[model samples]
Target: MGADVIERYVTDLGSRLQGSRRQVRDLLTETRDSLTDATEAHLDDGLTEAEAQERAVEEFGPVREIAHEYQAELAVAYGTRTLVWLAIVLPLMHMAWEYGRMLLIGPWQDFGTMPPAWYLFIAQANDLTSGIASGVALVALILGRILARKYDTRLLAKVGAGVAVVAVGTVLLGNISIILATAHLDAARLVQSAPMLVATLISWIVIIRFGLLARRCLSCATIVA
Candidate 1:
C-alpha cells in the first residue's frame, strides 16, 4: 500500500511537470528517496504501513507544489543553455552566410561594369551592422548565463529573457538593414543574397522559439530546495 501511494504520487508529480520525462524523473529522484526514508521512519515508530505512507506523503506536500518547484528550476536551466547555444551558433552562421554571399557576388567576380563606389560602401555598412549585432548577442549570452547560474530568482530569469529578446531583435534588425542595403545594389546582388536571406530567416525562427521558452521560464516561480 505504501509503495502504491509513493508510485502514484510520483506519477502524478511527473505528469504535472513540463520537461522531458527523463528530466522530470531525474529531478524528482532525490525527493522520492527522501520521502521513502521518511516513510520508513514512520513505520519504525509503530505506525501501520498505510498510515506511515500517508504521513510521508503529507510531509512531502502536494504533488503540484513540488512539481512546480522543480519545473521552475528546470525551465531556467534550460533557458540559459538554449540561449548560450544560440548566441554561439547564430553569429557564426550569419557570418558564414555573409561571406558566402560576398564571394558569390564580389565586384571583381563578374562586372560588365563596376557598380558605384557607394554600393560597396553600403555593403560595408551592412557588414558593420552584422558585427554589432553579433557583439550584442554575445553580451546577452554571457550576462544571461551568469545570472541563471548565480541566482534562482524569477526576476533574474526574466532579465535574462529580456536580454535574449533584445539579442534576437538586434539580429533581425541587422538582417533587415542588410536586405535594404542590397536593394541599392544590382538586382543580381539580391539574387545572390537569397541563400543568406534564407539562412537569416531560419535563424530568426530559432531565436524566436528560444525566446518564447525563455518567457515561459520567466513566468515560473523560483524554486527553493
Candidate 2:
C-alpha cells in the first residue's frame, strides 16, 4: 500500500472506535506518525516509498487489531483509575454519612430501649458485619485495580463477583437490623424518623446499584476479551 492509502486506513479505523473526534484523531495521528517513522527508516535501506509503506503496514498488522489494542489499553487505564477513586472516596463517604446520622438524630430510637445486653450484642454484631463487609470490598477494589493494570479480564470478573457478594451480604445485614429494631420498638416512631429511614433506604439502593454496576463491568470484560 502507498503512504496515503495506509494513512487513510488508519484514520478510518480510528473513526470506527467510539470516542470524541479529537480523541480519535489524536490516536490515529500518533499511529500514523509512528508508522511513518518506521517507513522512513525502511526507505533509508534503499526501498521505494511504496515498498516501505507496504512493509510498515505489514509490520503494524491489521488496522482493526491495532485499534482494538489501543482501545483496550485506554479502557483499562481509565477503569483502574476510576475504581481506585471509588475505593478511596466511597468508604469514607459512607462512614461520614453514618456518623452524621448517628449524631444528628441519636441512635435508632426504636431499638434504644431494648434490654442492655440485647443492644450491646446487636451493636457488636453490626460493627463486626460492617467491618467485614468494608474490608472485603476494599480488597476487591484493590485487586480489581491491579487486574485492570494487567488487562486481565477474568481477574476483573472475579473482583466484580467479590464486590457483588459483599454488597449483598451488607444489604442483608442492614435489612435484618432494621426489621429487628422496628419489631422491638415503636413502628410508628421508626416511620416518623424520616431521616433514618431515608438513609437506610439509600444505603440499600447504593448496594443494589453497585451489584448491577459490577455485573455490567464483568460483562464488558467478557465481551472485550
| TM-score of candidate 2 against the unseen true structure | 0.54
Candidate 1 lDDT, 1-225, residue by residue in tens:
655888788888877776444676787787789878989999999998888888999999998778767777666565555456555766576677667756665544467776577766755665565456456656765675677567644434455456556655665566566567657564555555576657657766765775565555444422322
Which number leads on lDDT?
Answer: 1
Pairs with steric clashes in candidate 2: none
TM-score of model 1 relative to the true fold?
A: 0.67
User: What's the lDDT for all of these models?
Assistant: 0.64, 0.62
Worst 10 residues of 1 by lDDT: 216-225
lDDT of 2: 0.62
Single out the weakest 10-residue window by summed lDDT for candidate 2. Answer: 74-83
- In candidate 2, stretches whose alpha carbon ends up further than 4 angstroms from where it belongs are 1-30, 39-54, 71-79, 110-133, 141-216
What tens digits encode model 2's per-residue C-alpha lDDT throughout 29-63? 88888889989999999998988988888898787
CA RMSD per model (angstroms) = 4.6, 6.0
